[model samples]
Target: MAEQLRLVVPLHGEQVSNMQQLVSVMLVDDEIMALNNLKNLIDWEEAGYTIVASETNPRNALESFHKYRPQIVLVDIMMPVMNGLELSREIFALNIPVRILILTSYKDFLYAKEAVEIGISNYLVKHEINEESLILELGKLKYEIQNTETNDRYLRQRLIRHLIGGLLPPENLEIGIKNKYLDFKIGSLAFLFAKIDTSYPILKEISVVAKSHSNFIWDIFNLANDTEYMDAIRLNPDEAVFVIYFKEEELKETVREIASKTCKKMQERFQQDYEHTISIVPIIVDNKNQNIRNIYSIAENSFNYSVYMGKNIIIDYESIPTAVNSSFKEVSVILNELESDFVKRDSESLKNRLNIIFTLLGKPPWNPEDVQNTCDRLVFTLVKFRNKNSIQDNPSKIEISNLFNLNSIRKWFESEFISSVENAVTIDALRYSRIVRKILVILHHEYNVDLSIEEIADRIHLSAVYIRKRFKNEIGITILGYLTKIRMEKAIELLSTGEYKVFEVAELVGYSSSQYFSKVFKKYSGLRPLDYTSGV
Candidate 1:
């Protein structure tokens, strides 16, 4: 009979909490029956732990340990091929922080001592042990796992906050690196900023195809230590930034393959199950001799390029143009354009000109800092405009420089621009006011002639799509329909005066033929033109 049997003893009819706060355990022994008996050795849930894996073969036990990363292991010392000591050493070599206890015979005291030397947490005498002692040791192991995980999480939380707040010096960041608590050294960390808009349910489906959001995040955190490091933390509902630490020389070979492959696999899975977009922008901080604060600043400026880059992509910061601020004559021109476009509610022109100007600033030979400063300079103009203009959309002064990605920057600008224009622009100049009023004015004066919605859009320096959306949103009807209603009302007024013939009245109210005009008038007015002319 084979000694190695891979299994997890099923606890039938037992329901576990979805967010169970339980430490997981694995057991290994030569006897299958002994493995089964060990399952009942501790009240797993009560001790805040559960038996996740049980295998008779030491080889199978090692495999399961790596796969599940169980927090605790209980193994028998006397086994063929790989004894308990060899197995414990192999487990500890992974450096994943698991507690391993050996089950040995009293006659095997020498072997037990050797096992202890190999870093086994403790050894249990097979003949002497009872549930009480087993439970006591298990409780201690559970405490150790709890304390370690808690401390690691606390350290990580503090580090992340400090980095985000830009509060820590490079020396402070090096503390975690020196202690091997973080996956990478302080000087070699890179940031991968991503914008993900997904529901938990959708993520669950995607998770089945690819790594879960949590696992992918943690993988990068420990990429400096090993490729297999897995962890995840959600920053908020929309955005998350993952860190990958790497040496500058490793960027071409080892790091690029790992980073690109991870991103591509996740992106392919998302494309398979979901239709929405995802954004990933990777920026190497070049921290070997740079300050931590400078890394954060530069990385942020570089990531802003991703706004132009679509979702489900892996973008390298080095490949994109770094923005530099120059006091070129073009800066003032762009600002002047933004001031007029924002007030005129001319989104199409505004966006086009912005894309051109932003590209100009982002071209080669530009420092990323100066480019961001240029953008900051432009935003300041918008802020000044907002203060004087009607509240078309006063998106509060978000430190645009503080925004990390291109998509974020463009989204913020588009959403808050027309509405947040300066008070001095006055309400009448805004899109809401201008688009609606302009359309009405055009139709009122031109109702007696041929006028198309496209023509109205052209006259206002806006697209038909923009006009239609704003028209329907504000006036509650399609442009053509509104034009028809105005034409009909004018026709009725002309007929009531009883001065012009029906054909003449039709031409006067924008009808090419009096016949089509009469047909439309009767349908809308519930009577022929003559009946209406009779004043009935």
Candidate 2:
């Protein structure tokens, strides 16, 4: 059985009845007497309906409808300012799931056909709206409304598909609006594009985790005071976009942080649930392309920065200098160096070579699609090579497919090459080098943890003295010195972000004492943390 969603809000008169759940209803008519009669005409609570709003003025109908968002609306066909059809049109514009009934006299009932044309589904002549007929229609409409809610999931998916494919013109929003599929609106808008990676297919998980993830995203941003409405549109597999309707002032100041935090929370939750992180590249996109191709094009280009900035990270398109996509020939050089570094157990050399490749791709005057396709090809080749060698750690197809950015390729290469070098390291003591390599991996993953050579030696069944000597011989640095270098590098990187204070950065780099971290940082970088920030 499909699970049902129960949404409850306190009604104005909660104690009026013993019913815990009731379908909300609304009545709209030009005559005050008619409105009152409709409200009292049926034993609504007995029929599982509650008249939340009754308005004699059509001008006030829309306001009441919006505020209550009632499931059923009974509106008169002819009225001043706005007739039932006009009011219904606006009410339907919100794309809310509502069953609208047209209330008309015999003369006005001629246009009842028109009400159906305007998306009204039920109609009843004024004299005929008694308890029996009202009961029958409400019961029938209630069933249809519940069925519509049942199918709402697919509708939302269709809405997202339309948004990602590019929304039609405002005039064309009618068909979608008439079906009550989505609230079509235009205003101060900012967009965020997300790149997701998961082993499970999105379709299989659409009902639960996917919806929960989407809900979590909105919950994160809606907490902000300056935003009125926030929504997300899932793009093609592994891609999604968040749309924020912000106050004009917030457009410049808050959008970037909201986008960043959303990216962070999403990656963290997936890592928690799936045991794998979905690296996201989020950027504020240009709304100027609402009708043109550039709307998604600019966002796609910015997301491609995952190539340079790395995974499980956020890069704002506006903050970074634009990069150019590389040509096929230029990318081929990167491939050559990759092979050489793999053969030589040269991780550092590979890092530099990959850095150069990404830097070239990060520059301007390049096609975003071409570069993304190139990265995809590169990741595919690397994964195929890893599988061919029977390496234990091959990236899942989902991960490889999500490698549509530069930083993604860089991270994958560093990791795979580390394993490659480990499998075939040509040092005099093979087991010793492997032990040292294991230590390096720990340092990389747990840079935030307070760690020492003794602790690591115990973790991997080696003596502290042996680990120290072998690490120095194989990697050319004392364990302490290496740890200090890694910590200092992290400190500098965090300080450069300008987001954290010296003490916070110190803690983040595994230093309990800001003073000691600063002392070590100064020795390594030739400057204090604050001083380094000024230069950056």
- Model 2 residue 246 distance off true place after TM-score fit, in angstroms: 10
Q: Model 1, clash count?
A: 25
Model 1 ranges off by over 4 Å: 1-20, 40-47, 107-112, 127-133, 154-298, 303-328, 331-536
lDDT of each: 0.61, 0.63
Candidate number with greatest lDDT: 2
RMSD of each: 19.4, 17.4
- lDDT of candidate 2 over 138-205, digit per residue (tens): 89988887675545434544565565577643454447543443433332455556655332211232
**lDDT of model 1 at position 467:** 92
lDDT of 1: 0.61
lDDT of 1 by residue, 104-194 (tens): 7666667767877878898888877778888888888878876766666546655654656566534655574435633344234445565
- TM-score per prediction, in order, is 0.44, 0.42
